[model samples]
Target: MASIHIPTLMLALLSGFAMLGVQLWAAQRSRLRYLDLAVWTWGSWTLLAGFAMLTARVVVPVWVSALLGNGLIALGIVFYNEAIHRHVLGRALPRWMWWSAPTVAWALTAWMLTWPLAVRTSAISLVFALLLCPAILVLLGPGWRGESSLRAVGLTLVAAAASLLLRSVHALTNPEEYRDLMQSSLGQGLTFLFSFICLIGAGFGFVLANFERIARRMEEMASTDGLTGCLNRMTADALLRHELERGRREGTPLAFVLLDLDHFKDVNDCHGHHAGDDALRAFAAEVRARLRASDVVGRWGGEEFGLVLPATDGPGAARLVEQIREAVATLRLCDGDGHDFTLTVSAGIAVAEPGGQLTADQLFMRADRALYRAKDGGRNNVQLHDSGWELGMESPAA
Candidate 1:
């Protein structure tokens, strides 16, 4: 096997990590100010510091290089694991978990000072492997199974862990060959090479993961109402058109409902805008809870919401709307001044039977007209289009 200069490899890794750390720091300062990115940046820099200390092992005191150097390396791995955990699960790891492995690794490194050099090396390698395990579990967890970037990050961590474990075993079996830290042995070369590659892969993988998260958030912001967390008007219109076409092709019925909160302006005027906003969010949640997975709901405008129910007939739509109205009536809300209040919703339902030739606009208009009738018929009622001006069953005042 060929010899590889360990010092040169360390230098290369040091420079690479420094650059990666700087780039990540810059990204965190940019529009992508994610907590994970900040944590990853710190991890890279810590790794850089550890590598720098290790590279200067020939000049620094033995304890500094072996104890502080290895300790920093283990700490850096912990940071990386924490960053992945936060990014994948949107939460921090336990405090004990954060400090436990690194502290043990550092203490073990000190305890092995008088032991064989290879044994010390093996202990540190195992520590690195231990630190990476949690990140791998989090990245491959079921919650993020569909995220390709996270999968890539997880696989990279797997490779790094495998390499570390292999190094630990090799050091134990070939202590003579791993006697010195700066030796020109193939094992040392391969270990550092693996470290270099894994470093680059992990850094890029984290960046990709951050981008994926940002993209998903942007898409959500575009498609959903920020206040109510319901589909926005434009997205709702597009979905309605698509669902209508699907219903026509499949010979299925579809229902469109327009709902408005009764006296919503009075809620704002009497309580405040904050109270009004709370009521809107509560009404949206109630409607969403009553809907099937296949149903779609959107915020049409202030105090108004739209619902699209596929494969639903007039009676089914009317029943669901009535249920939503009753649910709204039961919501106990409070104003900024701690005064309690209640709310009511009026809904208008328009159903398109199988093979009906109703355009999206026409269907929306019919639902809108029905909604107005519900509002005009003394409020807090459900009205169905084509039901011959029959006033819907009016619920008592909230």
Candidate 2:
């Protein structure tokens, strides 16, 4: 039986810790709790400390290595379990369980110090396996279903736990053949090697998961309005064009509703620009609440918004826009001094001509004309686009 290479295992633990530490710092600086990267970082550090002390057994007393070193390793496993429970299970592990598990692990390990070498080895292995059980169950549980990354991480942890369990089983079944851990049989050597490899693999899997989340958030921020949390102008334009093409092909009606806040300049003058910003957000929220989920709204520009409503005619769009206008009229906004004031919105509706060759730009122009009519007639009403309404005519139809 070949002896387990203690130095080699310690070096692997050290290297893994170094890499994970750098990644933890990067995650911290980014202000992202995207994954359980912070928890994993702490686990790695504790595991590194345990392995370092064990490797220096000559300088560190035997009892210290047997008690404190093993306790640190157990704490590291508990941390890893917590990370899995939170990120993979999508829920937090109980606080009592987190503290109690480590207390029990340390107490049991210390008590076993007086036992025979083989008994101590078996006890330690069993304790570590028990420590990993919670994380393993969560990974295989229903919460983790359909997640490939979680499955990969779960499988690696399972293998590491199995290795520990097998080492314990081997020690108990073949007590005569059991030797010192650093000078042991094939089973002991494989256990250490597999555990080291699994730890490194889990670290990489967690880091990759966080990076994927960051990428998704970046894409969303780019396409969404930062202030109103609605679709931005560019994203809205593209989506509206796509909906227009689909409606044209399917012979369904599509309508574009353009809304402009009436006398927005007055609000900014009375209160501060901060109040004006609050008014804009309040208006967008009311529009969203009054419309259906399928209705798409975007911040067209300052004091203006646009909506693309599928399968709707001019009258239908006008009714929806009218509801939103009434809702906005009821909205009360607060100024810096806590005074409240109501605001009104003007809307223009342009329904797509079924099976016509009209482009999105032409649709927008017609809607803009209707919006001008609404502004001209009275600054707080909805206007549907009239075919006879001319863009440059002074008295456009309302």
Give the number of the best model, judged by TM-score. 1
Model 2: lDDT of residue 68: 74
lDDT of 2 at 255: 95
* Residue-by-residue lDDT tens digits, candidate 1, 1-398: 68888878778788789889888988899965899889998888888888787777889898888777887888888888788878877788778866886688779988888898899888888888878888888877852574578777788888998998999898999898788888888887797579556966888889888888798999999999999999999999999999999999999999999999998889999999999999988888899999999999999999999999999998889888888988889999999899999999898888888978999998998898888878888889998888444355443221
What are the per-residue Cα lDDT tens digits for candidate 2 across 318-347? 778888888888887899999898899998
Give every collision pair in model 2. none
Off by over 4 Å in 1: 97-99, 387-398
Best by lDDT: 1
Error of 1 at 294 (Å): 1.4
lDDT of each: 0.86, 0.80
What does candidate 1 score on TM? 0.93
